[model samples]
Target: MKDVYLFSGFLGSGKTSMLTDVIRQLKEKNLKPAVIMNELGKLPFDSQAVEKDIPLKEMLEGCICCSGAEKTEAQIQSLLLDSDFDVLIIETTGAAHPVEALDAVYSPLFADKLNVKGIVTVADSKLWLHRETLTPQVRSLFMEQIRHAHLLLANKTDLLTEVEQGQVVYELQGLNPHAFILQTTNGRVPLHLLEGLKATTQADKADIVKAPIASLQLGSRLVEFTDVEFSQEQFEDWVRTLPETIYRMKGYVPIEGIKNPMLFQYAYGMVQWLPEYIKMPAKLVIIGENVGSLPVIGMN
Candidate 1:
């Protein structure tokens, strides 16, 4: 049976960084690793992080838990048949709930062929501290991710003070006393600790499968800026005007005076822009509650 690991975390919580580290370690140990990456938009951004040689299946335009359940099962079957990998790592969309995602993976069609090792959740230290800023549904989703983790990583500890780190650990431990909590920087953790880790008991699995799948009430919009250029100041102003319900936005954008499109990312209230040497499609995927109805100019 192939070992399967599910990577769960909120947007910009460093799931990709942790996934890359895990892939590197697996390769060093001479294990072939495959990935199933789920994205909320038609265009995939994070799938690019997977190396060319790794067998990858991309699930786009919906979350695997609800809208893409059958597709997920089919993809898993395809990967098992077509790939020679010993390990399968599923990196779920940041907006996904852990229980729902797990249920989707436990489909009978492919469940017997695989062994689910565990769910590794990367929780952003700062985000936990400021979770009150999130909408009620999102905050509950974040807590559920931590509550169901077998190995909980308090990542981005470098951004927190000693006191803040303690608070994060204390709160996370309260939520999930059974999980092995590790304070990590840049999602770094020893791969040896992941061996034989199991997140859910059989009883827990039964409950998860039977539990009603809660709708996150989240929506997404793809904003294309094919030939548009925005001044840095103008973009910042627009970002500032965004409502609190708008949780995550990421993609490439054309910036004034830049030779190539810049990689833009926004989570919670933070905004980051990184220079990209190569030109990419200038489209941003905005994810949040009622994102499609958001009254924003130029985004439509």
Candidate 2:
């Protein structure tokens, strides 16, 4: 049976960094491994940064737990048919719910061939301590990811003192007594901890208390503009002024003067922009709650 692993965590929880480590170590042991990186935005950074030698399948434009489910299943099936890897690692979008992600993986087509060896979740220590400060929907998303984890890595422990790390572990244990929790720095977990994970099945899962995912008002909007450039600083200022309800936003836009289309992302109150080569329509997918109207730099 082929082993399948799911790595889940919230945004900026270090899932990609950990996955990169696992892939490198697995290759050193002469094990063939493949990866699936799922993203909510069209522009993908994690997949592009991973070691190019390993086979990678990028699942983009939507969450694998929802709209991207069908595409995810098809891609995995395609991977299994083409090559027999020692393990298949699935890195879910930070916003995804673990149960839904597993449902996608356990689809009937590959049910007999693939065994879910484990579900590894990485938790941001600082975020966990201050979860109440987050919006209800964001907090729920973070907690739900921990609910069904077989292994929970309380990552970023270095940011806290020893006493604080212990408290975080204890609190998380209260939330999920079944999961084995380990603390790490920069997601530097030992490979042995990932081995021999008890294979889990649908029968093992408890009836999940459904979160108000629909009521959370999660949505996406596509905004388009005629090719034109605006002052980079002005564009960034507009991004910073977005309402707190806006959780994530990304797009490629043509700047008034810059030659290359600019790729930008706003998440966790942080905004970033970079030069991108993919020449698509100058459009942005704004994802948030009640994201009614946004500032446009150069529009027709």
* lDDT value for model 1: 0.78
**Candidate 2 lDDT score relative to the true structure:** 0.74
Clashing pairs in 1: none
Cα lDDT for residue 291, model 2?
A: 42
Model 2 lDDT per residue over 203-275, tens place: 1012221222221223334455553566778787777777886666556667767776687766558878888
lDDT per residue for candidate 1 within 87-168, as digits (tens), equals 9999999999876676566543344467777788999999999999999999999998998787899999999999999999
TM-score of each: 0.67, 0.67
| Distance from true location, Cα of 158 in model 2, Å | 0.7
Alpha carbon lDDT at 125, candidate 1: 96
